[model samples]
Target: MTNFVTKESLFELQSITNPVLAPNEQEALFIRTQMNEKENNYNAHLFHIELASGHLTQWTFGNERISSPAWSPNGKLVAFLVKRGEKQQLYLLNSRGGEAQELTTLPNGVNSFLWSPCGEKIWLTTSVKEGLAITDEEEKEDKKFPKAYVVDKMKYKADSLGLLPQNRHAQIAVVELSSKEVTAYTDAPYSHSLQGISHDGKTLVVAVNRVDNTDDVFRTPLYLVDVDTKEEIMLIEEDGYYGDAAFSFDDRYIAFGGSDQTFKNATHGHVYIYDTQSKNRQKLTEMFDVPVGDYAVGDTQQAASAPTVMWTENNDLYFQVSTEGDVRLYYATLEGAIYPASPENEHVYGYAIFKNGNRALMTVSNPTFPGELFDFDITTGERKQLTTFNAEFLANTTLSTPEAIVYPTKDGFTVHGWIMKPANYIAGEKYPLIVEVHGGPHTLYANTFFHEMQLLAAQGYGVLYVNPRGSHGYSQSFVDAVRGDYGGGDYEDIMAGLDYALANYDWIDEARLGLTGGSYGGFMTNWAVGHTTRFKAAVTQRSISNWISFNGVSDIGYYFTEWQMLADMNNVEKLWHHSPLKYAANVETPLLILHSERDFRCPIEQAEQLYITLKRMGKEVAFVRFPESDHNLSRTGIPSLRVERLAQITGWFIKYL
Candidate 1:
């Protein structure tokens, strides 16, 4: 009998995002994305969900996708981004809903946009063209540039479109809605673009990263621009990479999140607040240490760097903090008062503050639930479930809640982990155990809901996940312990965690152990199999095997490998010594390599290298590649493919373990 999970069952529920409360606070405008299995694409449209009537209306229509809907201060109009082919232009529509009028027709497209206080104009950041001059003599002299030498010296490289002309830098632009006039605000040789506009509309901030490379952390700077004259002043110098700056309502201060510099095994994110007039900046939450395991599960390279900050009407600034190995919401007063909101929630992904200041809408999930919308009241400190995406389906399915476990590492560090007992588990029956590792080698896997883990538990197998060394959510030193010792301390941490489970959990069968992970987790999975024969089966996704080849192929290859491994291609011998591929001959477990064809993050080549090497060594291995998918196949890919990927993973383990 074929046990298959279909797209309909996976995405029958709607996913909502970017919830903006109407000025009246009676309704909210949000983006509802539904999967179109026939087209194998997502259909995203604007929606207005009413609080009283429970009525929902589709606000935007047509083939183009509309997102990032921001309600005008006057509540008369809505400004959002509309995608037409490769171009993403800003458009305005009446709140009552009608035809959208195009506001700006930019060359490359807008990354982010915000409406001015008066709503007469919209400020946005877009990629702009910069011409290059080439000298015939210089072109002929250089072997690398035999033809016409074209120079585009910009801070950031333009994201490529199929055949469209590329622009290296992004600049801030202002578009007057009534006049339909567009003006370039700050156009620099190196790309500088706007990030957020203050409530007063006097100050505009932009995040400008290094143009030619991806080591943005070291080169990106946040600059302040005058909205009227477009004169730009460097607020945060082009130093360590930083982005996501949100201004307080009074424009008295600014809060931004990022790191000071990229270091080996360094994955901590710092949130800083600056006084506009005093120009004084203080880093907040330095006391709350971030664990390396948390970074391993979180989006370490990009998402972790781009933290969201918002100011409440009460003068308290709210931001996201991934402390204690869990991502949660926290609020800080302008006077340096800090407190956590909803600290009890296991995992809260996305959130939006309501206009009325009474409540906020958040996307919350735990070990059992997938993702559900919740209404959280600020004044009452109460949370109410608003929407259940898969309640009905889940009621009929057997799911197990993951139990949080604390285990001692070999080095005397107490590691945290979660274990899911098999569904309908018999009291004395032993079950196979799956050790799932998270990516980022810096992210965290908390006691939160994971559909894949639930599905494995539903299949009568125990699933175990731990915060090993190099993972985040512990102390900074503990997080940095795995740096330069990738396969050493981190390997010991996982083994120690596993040993704890084997010794404590009676239902876990040690002989039937399996392993799986993606990206950095994939790398660890590969590393784990090479180091031990305890795992009966293994599945690695978007993993890195050979650090030398990875250093040159991946988009983040140069910096990530250099920083994490504490070496570059010049240290080829050291890179190879630490790589899992070096010990491919020791593998006895049947392994499956899953990757995306267009995954620029880890690159599919990483999987191919491991597959070929394992097969050559007479080991059982299979390679699965997803077409047209990026590194975020599980979280952001087509619903159909995501379900299939999970099913394939389950099948692989069942067949072998």
Candidate 2:
């Protein structure tokens, strides 16, 4: 007998990421991430899938975590990153057999690395202080007697990496595989990212901002350094953010994905090719309306970073595009013609192209299951399931399939959304509806397996999620429309989607409607309840309550508020005009505020402000805080805490809705 998906069953699911085809093309290497329910954390290890035999092999063991597995060009060794003490360093393991060996022990550790074409050396990026090379002992001593942080730069704190070192910047380095000797290439004050080495391994490319006194993080230029001489040459000097670069097979052109920041953060990322000889750049994705990266947000697992561009030997550029909530692979020719490289209705999170250009190893997820590896035949359009990581769990579990719907707003503008039916549906029975908003007012709710939505469906509630105007899967104008006017059209888009569902679906209980969202979605939930009493209950997570305080508190609030809301602390009236806290007394729905204690993006103080204001106003509100959690608590936080969060959301709706 099949069973409905339960929170406990979350441990049964596995995550597959970073699929890279072996140089021989007979197998592929990927990281398998699994949750240890007993320990309440996640463990990831390296694994390889055999193409012809359909066999899976675990290349690493123990409880230690590892990631970013790269196969050497010569197919002799596989190098990956493993954490030791305070830093993550590179480790090498023989392809045939033997235990892995540590390659380098840099001070701050390696962030990312790439194997050279000859497999004789590995290029990497590591952080270092501008003039001070602090040793391990000094690093330990500083922790014993902590000093005050001297503030200098505008970009001090990041969401994931936390507080940045005063003068530390990421620099490029190379390690000779044979001698195990490391050499620093460039020493600069600005942070640099290691893109890749040329085909002949003589020239290296790194993305950085050498332009003076510019605080914009989105605008970066590409720089090429002679591997032996260490001489740096600027390639393209356009005022745009550029990374995910790859040199053409013949070393003539370099393809990268970026946006010119026309609309700031909401701009669509396009594919651009730079001619090495002429230093001229041409846009390759001018006609492709969708953004050139994965923007589908979910709570099922930790998201994987996909390459911005994958190049074939023939200079065929393949990349992923987020469109209408689903991520699809596309290949483009030099002349600007583009076509789909993967099937429809499937989210291709990450992919690695085989040298033959006809096959690719992809990490694919659909409505039915979590991510898994599959061998895709580009020519024949044949896909073979390479790994069955979630086969057992999926076989015993029953899930609801979402029905895609395209509806119009009050202004007749079309919007895309999905409605997931209750797991055990009947003909005439009415079911309660839950409207879920995604966090990135710029993100999408797509055709992927969302664990929270599935769990809600299992509990007899219909789940509805939509992509508003500011989402990335649409045109450039649509995404930019939500920048200055947050609560106007974007709010109507969500309400119109709910209206369409209630009008079209007779089995929905309009009186028992509930709303929930995180980040931007959380902000929307707060705005919706204050603006209207239609929703009976609501849950807001990691949300913003006051734009005034948000500008001062959030890590990205200073610039993000100016960019998204078109207002800063200087504009007090405009900032408070969009703040949900300003209208707290108007809230009629029972609201549940969930927030992470350490979330710097939308700090927990935002939740506190909302809870106290609603309580002072004698409104129905409750606050729940998770300690040591950040903005990503729902997705990559502590495993046990994630499960409890799902329970809290489910229980709140069950009691009120």
Candidate 3:
């Protein structure tokens, strides 16, 4: 059969995510997202793929968006959240396949929900009533506060469910499976818990961020509550954000990750094991490295959000470590003993540790291959390749293999990067170079198989990507070097890598240089053009132009900006001095700005500001806005739109370079 490639074909490729192995370990259930080009919406369905037979079947069907498939302990029934009309309601389905039964008639909507260990109850976090104010007249008349107007956080920024104010915080609710009754648990009118529940059903841990009118952003503290007695205890309190706590199998200690902010600078995260009985917290890992390459983790030198922590049957702690340019699994004991289970390989993105503990099911990818699941034996370090998701597609395509390179920055610090040569290239032929900047200023670029880099290489462009000062996988000091000096040494590190490529590789065309990046990478691209005219063309996606404006606009703008730059919005002059928009007059390179209209993390206004400025100055500039995309447009948006985005970006480079 001839392979058909089209705009529709781009949308036809379905994505499988959040794979959870069933209790029997014979089947895996995950969320499969299908993109409908006609509607420009993604339809997510729950699917169960048989491990032994390679049989794939869809379990959920309908117009509703179904996600977060959680199997019960018995593996007979699965619980998931479905968006019906305007509200997201909880539903239960038979593991085999059948019509799902609705569990909640919540008026507002459920944000997140999980099942109890014994499958006796369901815990959910949701926003119920609109909002209420403490009024003097209503308090005196009926001893009840008057209802206030509902403020939806998702309205202004189309991509996010905005941060609800103190008056409209989300509350936790527990629904007993037998009684079919729901009870509110710790409904604070002024604060909201980030995460809920322990491994055992006895205690509930919450990350509470107190809201006040003042600009002072208080830290998120971990609070423990006894399920039966309803007694809440403060477990861990520090001067930073903390959440994503995983309980040990015996429930003796709780492992959590947190970062500290001193002055305006934020430190990398440190994993801590908290003893519930003694009320003591011990630091587990001091510097857990963030993986380079994949942007799954946000820009942080420390471990990714929700540090992958699991307790083995042998009382050993198993977690993923992404230090040293590759992602690897590491085993640690409560007594601070740590070792790698499979330290031989350089790349391991996704993993699942079974309750059986003899083997670990994982999805491994390398520089040439996309991703394939494998069953790795813990005893012998043997691996068996399982599913070949895109084997045929890969066989038909000409993929590029990245070579890792290191070069010294002007400041004497060595920076790491991966370079991809043009596919089927002639020995002496020179090719145009594309400098791909990764998104997280804190994220690293590793030697993993990247579709975009391979596509660019197929198009006859040599792709060069580098992990600058702020990138992870490096030491904490190197990652922190980019903080408060965004465009300084990071720029030098990128330039040094480019210089190394030009000096070492004779087949690189320096005159035809092109640059592109999203998020922080986009910010650096915008900054790059303003500082130098080295690149012939550039594309900046979801970029930040004005730090001063970004501080007030973004979801984590207030705290993140302060944490990154060590400066608040009050330092407007300092922020603008570092902003790319301030140097727009010196920008000579042709630029293309791509932005998601609903992006709350970076906000579309940042893109608009740069586009309008460059166009008004009579420079070659174009702006493309994705209507319903979030900050994760490339990763999780409409499939066709993602292809179009790539086409537009490459097209811009083709036209200029």
Candidate 3 lDDT at 287 equals 41
Q: By the lDDT metric, which is better: model 2 or model 3?
A: 2
- lDDT tens digits, residues 330-414, model 1? 7676666667776564666667776445577776656666555667887788887666545765665656877888877667788
lDDT agreement with native, every candidate: 0.72, 0.86, 0.73
Model 1, residue 354: what's the lDDT?
62
lDDT of 2 at 254: 85
Worst 10 residues of 2 by lDDT: 132-141
Q: Write the per-residue lDDT of candidate 3 for residues 1-657, one digit (tens) a residue.
A: 323222233453444445677888887776656666676666777777787776877787766678677788788889988986667888888887678888877666677787887798888887644343211112132437655645443222324554343335577777778776778875566455535467668888876666544246557777887878978788777776666677877788887666666423325555678887898888777545442123333210111122356666666776666665676777777888777786533566666677656677666666676555677888798987666556666556666678888787777678878888887678889899999998777666665556677677877889999888887776667878888898888888888888899999999999999999999999999999999999999999999999998987887787778778878877877788779999999999999999998898999999999998999999889999998688987766666678888899879988998
Q: What are the per-residue Cα lDDT tens digits for candidate 2 across 1-657?
A: 999988776788888888988888888888888888876777789997778998888999876678788899888899999974469999999999899999988888899998888888898888887775522322444566878877666667766557866667788777898888877766778878887678888887888886545545557777787877878787666666777778888999888888876888898989988888897789899887789888888766554767899888888889999987789999888889898888888788889988657888899998877989888899999998888889998989999999999997776568999998999989899999999999888888877888888899999999899899998788888888899887889999999999999999999999999999999999999999989999999999999989999987888988899999998878989988998998898999999999998898998899999999999989989999998889999889988988889889999999997
Question: Against the true structure, what is each candidate's TM-score?
Answer: 0.88, 0.97, 0.87
Task: Give per-candidate clash totals.
Answer: 27, 0, 4
Location of the lowest summed lDDT over 10 successive residues in candidate 1: 154-163
Candidate 3: regions farther than 4 A off: 1-14, 24-27, 49-56, 62-65, 84-86, 130-159, 162-166, 194-200, 210-215, 262-266, 287-307, 343-347
User: In model 1, how large is the Cα lDDT of residue 187?
Assistant: 59
